[model samples]
Target: MATTSCDVAIVGAGLGGCFLAMLLRRRGQNVVVIEQGPSIPSAGADFLKPPGLRVLARHGLADLVGRHGLRRDHIRYYHDGDPIQDCRFPDGGFLIRPYRELVELIYTCCAMEGVEFWFGAEIGDIAVGGGGVEELTLADGRRLRAGVVVGADGTRSL
Candidate 1:
């Protein structure tokens, strides 16, 4: 088996994982993202809320993500054919984009920052020591050692 090391090993390539990887990489951390799927996930939430958009803007990625996304500022609810309530959003409202597209965009940014990605990687075993992860072994016999390990693999993650 071959062994490799990185500053951070993230177990997922989903939005959170990829976005975090990009941010960490921008801060000069050596990051490796491991995903069990063949590629970035194709299904997920389609709305980028205000808080999330703010975070992206803080990182100078708001424009990139919003370039082709649909923008909405308000949503109205009706009851019995009568206008009930109108919910207005602040800060240009939220963005409407497919989950995969959003993730791919962030993934591209992470790649440009030199964050390594290992797709179709299945975790075989995780070694923990001193209340933290020490190493991760892949199903294909590859080992990864990192200063920090994050299980952003999602709701069904290990």
Candidate 2:
């Protein structure tokens, strides 16, 4: 009933999907985020370690994310219910924000970059040839053709 296209088409709206979509949009690529669910995912890793934090910082999102998340410089390690070690961050601290909140924040930024989102859009099939995906067909018969197709579905997926 509908048709759309973009420079990039991403499957799933999880953390990786949303994050990658944001990055691509920032790179001047028209992005389409397709999610089977009605909304972004609500649960996932809650810790943004130093490396991940740096990625945000490099993208100019450090302050925006840090403002709304918890900053902890120390992490206490436990083994068999025993606190065995405490690791301290030498530089910028880590961020502790719910996965949903983190993705939502990035999604907000993506919106400003004009990234398109399709919620409740279940993919039916992908047309592939010449060693790459060429198009996507939704269950409801919608078509999407993109120069690039990303399969960031979930932790465990097809």
Candidate 3:
């Protein structure tokens, strides 16, 4: 019944969504992330590759995101039960956390930045025009008007 507005409205609280929200909020944007599920998606890419870690470091989250997660410097490849060449990571290392745990860490950081999360808010209709999304209408009659809309809702997202 109530309409809300944000500088950026992102659908889905996956890795991309949470990371983007944190970035925008840090830059002084009011961000809202809508998720149809109760929390962040349970599964996704498991490794926080070096490039990604660098980006997080710029945001002062390098230690926070990597803390407590496994530091992976090497990985063994296998083919048909036969050991193949082992690949090694360069520089420091990559952070290896389960998909859920990785996302949860960023989600927690987003909360600290005042990013709003609308969990369990199923989306209904999206209005688009001017080569961009105009607004989003949720199933429960809630409308969100965002200056910009981002779809980080994962594969098969609508």
Which stretches of candidate 1 lie above 4 Å from their native place? 76-86
Clashing pairs in 3: none
The lDDT leader among the candidates is: 1
Model 3: what TM-score?
0.92
Would you estimate the TM-scores of all the predictions?
0.91, 0.90, 0.92
Q: How are the candidates ranked when ordered by TM-score, highest leading? A: 3, 1, 2
Clashing pairs in 2: none
Answer with 2 or 3, whichever has the higher TM-score: 3
Candidate 2 residues 1-158, lDDT tens each?
66687999998888789889999988899999999989988878998999998988898988888887898899999999999999898787788999888889988888888889999988888888988988899888999999998889865544
Q: Candidate 2 — which residues are off by over 4 angstroms?
A: none
Task: Please give the range of 10 consecutive residues that has the lowest summed lDDT in model 2.
Answer: 149-158
What clash count does candidate 3 reach? 0
lDDT of 1 by residue, 1-158 (tens): 77899999999999999999998998999999999999998888998989999999999999999999999988788999999999889878999999999999999999988999999999999999998999999999999999999989878888
Clashes of each: 0, 0, 0
**Worst window of 10 by summed lDDT in candidate 1:** 149-158
Q: Which residue runs does candidate 3 get wrong by more than 4 Å?
A: none
Backbone clash pairs for candidate 1 read: none
